[model samples]
Target: GGSASSGQVSRGGGGSCAFGGMGGGGRGVYAPTHVRSPLSPQQVTAEIKRAQSVVEVLRVHKRFRSAFNYIHLSATWNVLGRLAARAPAWLQQHAASAGALREDTHRLLCELDAQGLSNVAHGMAKARVTSRDMWAASW
Candidate 1:
């Protein structure tokens, strides 16, 4: 048995200390070994453009599976959203015509539906159609 003040439990020949006891045993704080640098405006724009192009190609092919990996598309969209959230005013203004991004997302949804990937499509549909301004507001 252990006393609250002593924070020690005796069993057999050994004793174990509780939290805040003489000996401490708790989870260590998380610290990243490498810190990622923020992307430049140009880089963000380039990534958005690249994702747009890929989606365009997929739409033209009418097959998202062959042209794009689901995980990759998801990750790219995530990155784009994060970048957009931090975009400057000038970049936000440029992102106003996020029509293409919306269109591509719709096309992906259609492709997923056609492929009977309803579960994945449903999950993806929850993600808002990203516009540069939308991302900026998210922050």
Candidate 2:
């Protein structure tokens, strides 16, 4: 076991996070700066749309996977298609996340309208995601 450094603070719950020293003649205690509000579904959808790389897409997906509505889910699928088209090699290394996204999409299939399902199918084709479960669910 190592000793906690001056810049390290235990944030309770048995975890310690490293924090920069407090300057400006202030106490060296850690403060919660810039706490993020959760992004709304529309905001998340927009984020998915604006993602330029596989890593960005996966990061957003992992962050908001359980919060996605059908619209957000559809948008994620579409962006994944674009990502696949733009960077097939880079996307290959993230097959696990892709598979998890597939599972999430699969669970929400019934919520998608015809056009949403169409977009999903089109995206899957573009991304070459030939999962039998996915194809069968779209039927």
Candidate 3:
């Protein structure tokens, strides 16, 4: 896992991006993300909302994906605003006390910040945010 590329942006993970030599010796290994479609603005929004809902649902219900999505849809509409805007305070206050729930909330925020769109990146940036509250809560 070297880097994931939607062509527009790429974040490296570990390994060299190419499969072969950059020295022009062998064939190159095309990254998987290079071949796949980047998530759309709509998709980003959806996922962000999903991540937020997952944390909230997990906090109370302690369920997995199916239950999380159910709670998420029932929770609210403006997923990004609802999720991203509300996270900071809760993350600060509760994350320290809550454990895994706190970590989930923190991660949700961070993912949102990194991927969240606001008419930037063609609005494709709108997505899940992972927060730093995880560290605070984990400790």
Candidate 4:
């Protein structure tokens, strides 16, 4: 089973991430190296709010994507858009994060508000994730 060795981030069970190529290869769901306990939605939101850098936001983003519900989804997109604007270069460097956000956005599109839709558009534009699926999903 794969584990987070030498500061690498490990992906959980039944999930794939580009962060370290460590996904279902593990025996079971691999908790991320940083998370000691499961984080609540409020905590995840606070973490996003408190984040000062792209890396910080991205580190917890997967967790947030999984944990967020209808009420928090809009703020999530808004924060992601703000983060994209603040660190466009970092967003490019960590493009996988954007992809995850895009996939989740598509899956949860019906749950988002108008502001969330706008923020998703703004953030995806900032990340240059202009794929046909994204366009189709928007319409």
Candidate 5:
């Protein structure tokens, strides 16, 4: 471990990361962090932090998954589709899927004639009948 040095880490190499070789090879005799060994304490901490971040991101997506605002935020899907025309097949597929899903949802919800879903609960007595016998669930 004498080959290692202890001091504040600094940016180095024109096209390198603070802790890893170019292209994130993540190698060097001396680790960028102070912790050492196979299960180095620093690596463990970074891993835990990364896991937590992923969990948090998933949580937020879950909460907003059904929100119309997020789904129809902008012409983003449409733009993606048009721009993906010359892109790779995978990207084109992604854009197409997004646009299709958005359109399908927009059509399905068209049964309820309103700019958007309201987050209020109206009494059963006030329920409006618009079809043979259908009721839109309140959010």
Candidate 6:
């Protein structure tokens, strides 16, 4: 424990636990923290549209590897899932077609699989389906 008072057993064998020497209070462990604000419906839609545009550009250039690396398609699907979970009903109703999104995700996975990144491809594939299911169930 970071604090002198912490980790000391009381008369009744009771003591408080401090996390990662935090209670000692002197220059305790410092780690950077990330705070993400929720995306507005417009922001979410714009991001999805951006991802779609990247996919199209990759297709045009036949740059599958760059697409995989630069676009982080797996993360895009994750963001989409989060949007589905948090988007308002009106937004969801007006959102892009789920089937098209699923198809695009499958296409990306197939490209990754062709490049011998089957592990990443499989993981993204599962994530796509899981997110879709979660979105559906949320409705």
Tell me the alpha-carbon RMSD of every candidate: 20.1, 16.3, 11.5, 11.7, 23.0, 17.8
Give the count of colliding residue pairs in each prediction.
Answer: 0, 0, 18, 0, 0, 4
| Top-scoring candidate (TM-score) | 2
Off by over 4 Å in 3: 1-9, 13-62, 65-81, 84-88, 96-139
TM-score of each: 0.28, 0.64, 0.25, 0.53, 0.21, 0.28
| Model 6: residue 67 alpha-carbon error in angstroms | 8.6
Candidate 1 lDDT by residue in tens digits, 1-139: 1122232222222222222112211111111222332544344334434644333322322322223322234444554444433342323344433444434343332222122233333322333332433433321
lDDT per residue (tens digit) for residues 1-139 in model 4? 2332342323334354333223332322233343343776577668777766667767767666655443344455556656666666664577687567656554444433445556666765664445543344544
TM-score of 3: 0.25
lDDT of 2 at 97: 79
Off by over 4 Å in 2: 1-37, 89-91, 131-139
State the lDDT of candidate 5 residue by residue for 4-103, as single tens digits.
1332122346534332333122133223443223544444333323332323322332333333221132222223233333342422334443334334
Candidate 5: which stretches are off by over 4 Å? Answer: 1-64, 69-74, 88-139
Q: lDDT for each of the candidates?
A: 0.32, 0.61, 0.31, 0.53, 0.29, 0.34
User: Candidate 3: worst 10 consecutive residues by lDDT?
Assistant: 18-27
**How high is the lDDT of residue 126 in model 2?**
78
lDDT of 2 by residue, 6-123 (tens): 4332332324212222321112322323234398657888889999887888888888876655566778778878878777654357767766786667555544556676788788
Give the residue spans of candidate 1 off by over 4 A: 1-72, 88-92, 95-97, 110-139
- lDDT for each residue of candidate 6 in 19-133, tens digit (9 for 90 to 100): 2222222222211121332554344334444643333423322322222221244445444444333333422343344444434444333222122233334533443444545
Q: Global lDDT for candidate 4?
A: 0.53
Residue pairs with clashing backbones, model 2: none
* Deviation from native of the Cα of residue 138 in model 3, angstroms: 13
